[model samples]
Target: MRLVESRLTLTVSYALLALFAFIALFPIALLVLNSLKPAAQIVQNPLALPETIRWENFTNAWNHARFSTTFLNSFIITGTTIVLVCTTSSLTAYVIARRKIKSWKILTFYLLATTTAPIQLYIFPLYFGFAKLGLINNIFGVALIYTALYSPFAVMLLRTYFIAVPKELEEAAIVDGATHWQVFWRVMLPIVSPGILTVALIIGLNSWNEFLIAITFLQKQENVTAVIAFFLLSGQYSSDWGEIMAAALIIVIPVVALFVFMQKRFIEGMAGGSVKG
Candidate 1:
């Protein structure tokens, strides 16, 4: 009876999960299918199967969106943002976790408290500040924004993971006559790498897909992907649904795949941090 109950419960859970999975994935699947059809084919039968694949749509989008330039700009911004966030956030976490210097706790609390507040309230001031600094519409400007926006959470996570690591490891490194920098680079960093990697992926994905700040700051239409390049597709002489879907698919698919590929590691990192803590 227990075996039968377990089997029945498993079956029910699987069925429900499958249903939800399909519900979530169906629209994305439809987008990809539509992207494969020509615009006229899409109109002739909105729900119809593709009569012929329109592989050129991707190429056309690549040109029409000025995607090459946009991608390069995005790459510069995302890569720089990730590097800055990881470096600064990790160092900040180390200070918060390990160093017992004056005002460190107060500073951390102050930073974390900022997260309880909303970014919307600060946008006006931030725009003027960025403008004064001549940072608006630049890759460095976006990187700065990403670092400030995401660093608090990253610092919190890293601090948790760092706290879980044994301090004796650092003591041993010191006994081995390694300097503080060496200890940080060679010993502490390796120990917290999984958490750092998870944080990096999260920050990278966020920076890659960020639209709001991009929309506000980026005036050069040819210089940004998600907001500037992608948004232009909607201006209508009749909607090019096929092209829109193609562009979206192009943007979304790789990020989805990256998450899928890295999800096990991400889960393991979170689990390991919890267990160690």
Candidate 2:
């Protein structure tokens, strides 16, 4: 009887998980279905498969959105943000992880507090200051903003990896006549690299999909990211649903591919960080 009950429970759990998966994937299925249909067909029956697939929707969207240019702009911003976040946050995380100083504790708390704080709290003053300095529409400037906003979270995340490293390694490095920089570069960094890769993927995804900050800072047509370009496809009076979906898929495919390929590293880094030493 116990064996039968265990089998029943396992079956029920699988059924529930399958149901949840369908719920999550249904919208994405609809988006893919509609992306191949014309606007007229979408209006007629959104759920129905297209009788004739319109491959031209992608071409039209590519041209209309100026994806060639916008994609390059997004690459610059996202790549810049990733590099900045990783470099700075790794150093900050290392210091916080190793130091037992009171000031470091306070600094960690301050960064945590800022994570919970609303962006609007400082965006106005920051925006106005940047505008005064003529930093608006500058890709590098927008990257700086992303670095400030996202680095705190990255630091917090990376600290876990650093904390996991054995302190004896750093001491041994010092005893071997290695300087602090050498100790960090040779000993700590290699160990925490998985965590860094995870941080890079998460930060890159956020930077690519970030709408409000990107739209606000990158106003010029030539400077806007792919997300902004996708947004411009729609307007108050009208929208091209088919093309909009196509554009969304374009932006999503690469990110999804990256995640799928690197999912092991991402999961390992996150899981490793959560285990208590």
Candidate 3:
């Protein structure tokens, strides 16, 4: 009886997990399915498999969205933001973790508060300022905005990783006549690299998918990011649902591929930073 009950419990657990997995994947499956169908077919039956696969949808999406240019813009913004955030946040996290400052708690609180605060509060002001500075359609300018918006969270997350490093390592490096910069650059950064990779992946994903700030600051056609380009594919009166789905799929592919590739390091970083010593 006991053995039977255990088998039953295990079966039920697997069943529930499979159900949740299906639920999570269903929308993505639908998106891929619809991308190969005609717009009229999708309207008639989204669940039905395409009678004739439409490979041209992908080509049409790429051309109509001008992904060639917009993808380059996205890469520029994402790369710049990642570099700036990682460089600054790692330094800041190291200082906060290693230094014995009384106001560190206050600074941490401020970062936490800012992370929760809505970007909507500052959007108008930021737009006006960027316009005055002639940065409205500048890729680098948008990157700077992403850096500021993302840095607080990056600093807070990296602080935990820095705190997890053994203090004796820093002391030993210092005793060997290493300067503070050398200690931080040569010793601490390498140990905390997984955390940095994790941060980069996160910031890259956010920067790529971010629409509001991208659309607002990059008004010029040539400067728009891929997300903005994808958004522009929809018409006020009508939209090609197949092409739209194809565009959406194209946008998601890079992000998904990247996450799959870096998932191991990302997991390690998250686990490493979970507990502070």
Candidate 4:
């Protein structure tokens, strides 16, 4: 009787999960299918399979959208942001966690407290400041802003992980004549490999898909994918829904792929293992 109940519960849970998955994927699948159909055919039968494939949709979307340049700009912005956030946050976290200094603790608290209530409405001043500095439409300028914006949370993440890291490992290295820099580089970083990767993935995804900052900071017609895609999809050619949906699908794929690849690292990073002194 217990075995039958367990089997029934497992089957019901899987059925619910499968139903949810189908609901989520059905729309995406419909989009991809319709993207291959002619507009006439799409309107005639939106749910029907393509009578003939229209591979030109992707080609048109790619060239017209300047997807290569968009991808390049996004990569540069995201890559730079990831590097800065990881380096600065890790250093900040290490200091806050390892030093045990009062000032450092106070600073950590101040930084972490920002996460409780963010100043979302105060960015207009910064926007005007960036425009005056001639930083608008520049990828590097956007990346710099993103790095600063994302680093506080990153510091909190790394600080928590660093607090859990045993100091004895670094201490032993210090006793054997390792300098603080050497200890940090050789001992601490290796042990926090998963956490570092998690932060990189998080910051990278955030920067990649960022809509408001990209739209606001980048004004050049050719500088931002998020801006370009938004305008393209929102234009009067609302009749050309296939291309719009295809573009959306393309842009979403990379971030989804990154998250899936790093989900394990993220989970392990936040599992909160003990820190020894």
Candidate 5:
């Protein structure tokens, strides 16, 4: 009787997991399928497979969205944000983890508070200051904004990895005549690389998909990121749903592929960070 009950529970667990997977994948499958259909066909029956694949939808989307420009803009913004977040957050995390100063605890608390603070609290002043400084519509300026908004979370995530590193290693490095910079650069950084990569991926995704700040700060047609460019393709009046879907796929495919390839690293870093601090 015990063996039978265990088997039944296992079967039910598998069934539930399968159901959830289907639920998650069903919309993505539809999006991909409908992207190949014409707007008329989608209107008629969104679930029906296209009789003829509309290869032109992608081309039309590319032309309409001016992807050539927006893709570069997104790449610049995402790359800059990643570099800034990783460098700044890793250093901050290390200092906080090691308690290098009497105020380290207070600094950590401040960072935690920033994470909970709402964007609305600061966006106006930030925007006004940026406007006064003529930083609007500038890719680097937007990247700075992303860096400020996302770095606290990165610091929190990376702090765990720093804490998990054995203090003896730093001591040994110092004993070997390594300077503080050298010890951090050559020893601590290499050990916590996974955590840094995890932070990079998360920051990149957030910067790429971020709509509110991107749209607000980047107003010029030439400066808009891919997300904002795609937003223009959609409107309340009428929209080319097929082209919209194609544009979405274009923007999403790269991110999805990257996550799929680095899924193991992402999972490991997240799990390892949580395991300790």
Candidate 6:
């Protein structure tokens, strides 16, 4: 009876997981399928396989979306935000974790609060300030906003990894005549690198996909991110759904490829960080 029940449970669990996987992948499969079909074909039947593969959709998307310029803009913004968040958050996390300051609790509360607060509350004020400073449509300015928006969560997550590191490493580094900066740079950072990489991947994906802030701040066609460019591909009266899907696929490919490549490290980082602190 026990053996039979165990097998039944396993079968049910596998069935549920398969169902969930299908649910998750269904939309993506549809997107890829529709992307190859003409707008007329898609309107007729989105589920139908294309009778003829139209490779031109991809080319048309690339040209119409101005991906040549927008892709570079996205890379610039994502890279800048990643570097700023990792450097600053790692330092802050290290200090908060190792120093045992009385005010650390207050700082933690502030970070938690910031993460929970909606960006909508500050968007108007931020836009006004950036306008006054002539930062609208500025690539670096958008990167700065991304950095500020992501840093709180990065610091909070990284703090756990920093805390998990053994204190003896810091003590030994200091005994060997290492400066505080040297200790953090040479010892702590190396140990918590997985956490940093995880933060970078998450921030990069968010920054790449972010449309609201990008559209609001980057008004110029030259300065818009890839996502914003993809959005602009839709016409007011009528949209070519095939071209739109192709544009969507183009924008998604890089980030999806990156996540797949770094998935192991990302998993390790999440697990390592969550195990303690």
- Give candidate 3's error at residue 58 in angstroms: 0.7
Top lDDT model = 5
Q: Model 1: how far is 108 from its true place, Å?
A: 2.6
Off by over 4 Å in 6: 1-4, 100-102, 235-238, 267-277
lDDT of 1 by residue, 62-154 (tens): 777877888888888888888998999898898889865788879788878876668788888999998898877787887788888888878
Task: Kindly indicate the candidate among 1 and 4 with the higher TM-score.
Answer: 1
Local distance difference test, candidate 5? 0.90
lDDT, candidate 6, 228-269, per-residue tens: 988887754129899899888988877778778988866665
Candidates sorted by TM-score, descending order? 5, 2, 6, 3, 1, 4
TM-score of each: 0.90, 0.92, 0.91, 0.87, 0.93, 0.91
Among residues 3 or more apart in sequence or in different chains, the pairs in candidate 4 whose N, CA or C atoms overlap within 3 Å are none
lDDT at 270, model 5 = 53
Give candidate 2 regions above 4 Å deviation.
1-5, 100-102, 236-238, 267-277
RMSD of 4: 3.5
- CA lDDT of every candidate: 0.82, 0.88, 0.88, 0.78, 0.90, 0.88
Model 5, span 111-196: residue lDDT tens: 88998899899999999999999999999999999999999989988988899999999999999999999999999999999889
lDDT of 2 by residue, 4-26 (tens): 66778989988999999999999
Clashes of each: 0, 0, 0, 0, 0, 0
- The top-ranked prediction according to TM-score is 5
Provide the lDDT at 176 for model 6.
100
The clash tally of candidate 1 reads 0
Q: Which clashing pairs does model 5 show?
A: none
